[model samples]
Target: MISDAPFASPDSEPTIRVQDKTLLGFRRSIDNIDAALIHILAERFRITKAVGEYKARTDLPPADPKREEEQITRLRQLAAESDLDPEFGEKFLRFVIDEVIRHHETARQSE
Candidate 1:
């Protein structure tokens, strides 16, 4: 079953527009953006899933904080180089990493 819009963040709410005769009205907008995010998130998971599968296949443990730290540092540096706010990017990436870890755990449990 479809769940609540996962894209609804504390800092932002998903905007739904009632611009047509659709029964969903604004729900369509919410679904559209939320659906797109799901696709993007799923594509990201494809890569991570491959990583997880390889790890499982090779019997490697999950949750590497050192690797995550290295990644945050590298991405933050890259973000600065790209003219983005390194601090902001770092914090955001860290949050995403945590989310990813949670997703990874859930996926592992399901398997």
Candidate 2:
């Protein structure tokens, strides 16, 4: 079975166990970014939850392919402009969109 963790392994070592000051500083920054990402995702989900409910109430489809495509295109352009990989941006957005669709499906089922 696949783990739900953002970073998961059957066996892994944490840098803290080695006690390298440089690595420790880098990890601290990474940890802060990870926490921020989680908070941003939480807020995104909260809004998506409200959107899912509205869609269900209005008898709209769970997945909006047109809008999804538009977002992908927009984000890809933004990613390129920001010197980030457009492909990675597309993949990330697709993952989030998939999760949102899953939530929308569950909301529909519950309603």
lDDT, candidates in the order shown? 0.75, 0.89
lDDT of 1 by residue, 1-111 (tens): 233453445676554334324747667799899999889878987888777766666656668989998998899889989999999998877877787777667666656
Instruction: Report how far residue 61 has shifted in candidate 2, in Å.
Output: 0.9
lDDT digits (tens) for residues 26-66 of candidate 2: 98999999999999999999999999999889889999999
- TM values, all candidates: 0.54, 0.80
The Cα error of candidate 1 at residue 52, in Å, is 2.5
Give the number of the best model, judged by lDDT. 2
Q: Which stretches of candidate 1 lie over 4 Å from their true place?
A: 1-41
What root-mean-square deviation over C-alphas does model 1 reach? 10.2
